[model samples]
Target: QENRITTVQCLSGTGSLRVGGEFLARHYHQRTIYLPQPTWGNHPKVFGLAGLSVKTYRYYAPATRGLDFQGLLEDLGSAPLGSVVLLHACAH
Candidate 1:
């Protein structure tokens, strides 16, 4: 007897992330998706096309041009349970 495993690879990080998000939106009970403010330009459109309502959470602080740690945490903490959140592997 022999055992075998197969794996499939999507394009790259971005492609994989998008595919995963779309899958969740389609199969899971996800209705709303929260994105970081000043995230990649295409993020909102991508999620919207996948049938998930897109919203933004505070991410960057214009005053410092840096990450808004406190605001980000607060927004996440306030979001409804089970809401999908999109995080970037690399800050845009």
Candidate 2:
């Protein structure tokens, strides 16, 4: 069977994250949310307020001005099973 995913459009990025955080906090078994390093300043607060433990995973590589693929893999691989990870994607 294919996995099912849900999507919702919100007024803003902050609002989207807030809504997602709250929904996940209530329905998902995982209580932790892993954000990419160097995420928005208010991310931690928003997720925390939703009762989810906020953590970060390596994402950006300053030296190359690109993704730290290896670091990202290591950090994510070490994360607890069922943890939620928020990844930023470019639409254009």
Candidate 3:
């Protein structure tokens, strides 16, 4: 079986993140949010405005100029369960 996901229409990436972050802040218990390192420039500001404690998890590997799998794992593994995570899945 497969699950369908619902989405919200927004003006842009920043708007979407801000809205989602605000929603989470209003409803969710976990206020701590983890973000991918070297994420979109506006991510921190967006989440911050929503009243979340923003943190970074390893994502970019400066040496390889690619994903840092190990560091990412370490950061994720250390996070408290239920913490919100902002993933940078694509540039588009």
Model 3 lowest lDDT segment of ten: 83-92
Model 3: pairs clashing at backbone N, Cα or C within 3 Å:
none
The per-model lDDT (C-alpha) reads 0.82, 0.90, 0.87
Of the pair 1 and 3, which is ahead by lDDT? 3
All candidates: CA RMSD in angstroms? 4.3, 3.0, 3.2
Model 2 TM-score is: 0.86
> Candidate 2 on 1-92: residue-level lDDT in tens?
68989678898989988999999999999999999988878999999999999889999999988899999999999998878999878511
Candidate 2, residue 53: the lDDT equals: 95
Quote each prediction's TM-score: 0.78, 0.86, 0.87
Among these predictions, the greatest lDDT belongs to: 2
Expressed as tens digits, the lDDT of each residue in 1-92 for candidate 1 is 47988566899766766786778777888688899988777777777777788899998899998889999999999999988887866765
What's the CA error at residue 56 for candidate 2, in Å?
A: 0.4
Please count the clashing residue pairs in each candidate, in the order shown: 0, 0, 0
Position 83, candidate 2: lDDT: 84
Model 2: lDDT equals 0.90
Which of the two candidates, 2 or 3, achieves a greater lDDT against the reference?
2
Q: Write the candidate numbers in order of decreasing TM-score.
A: 3, 2, 1
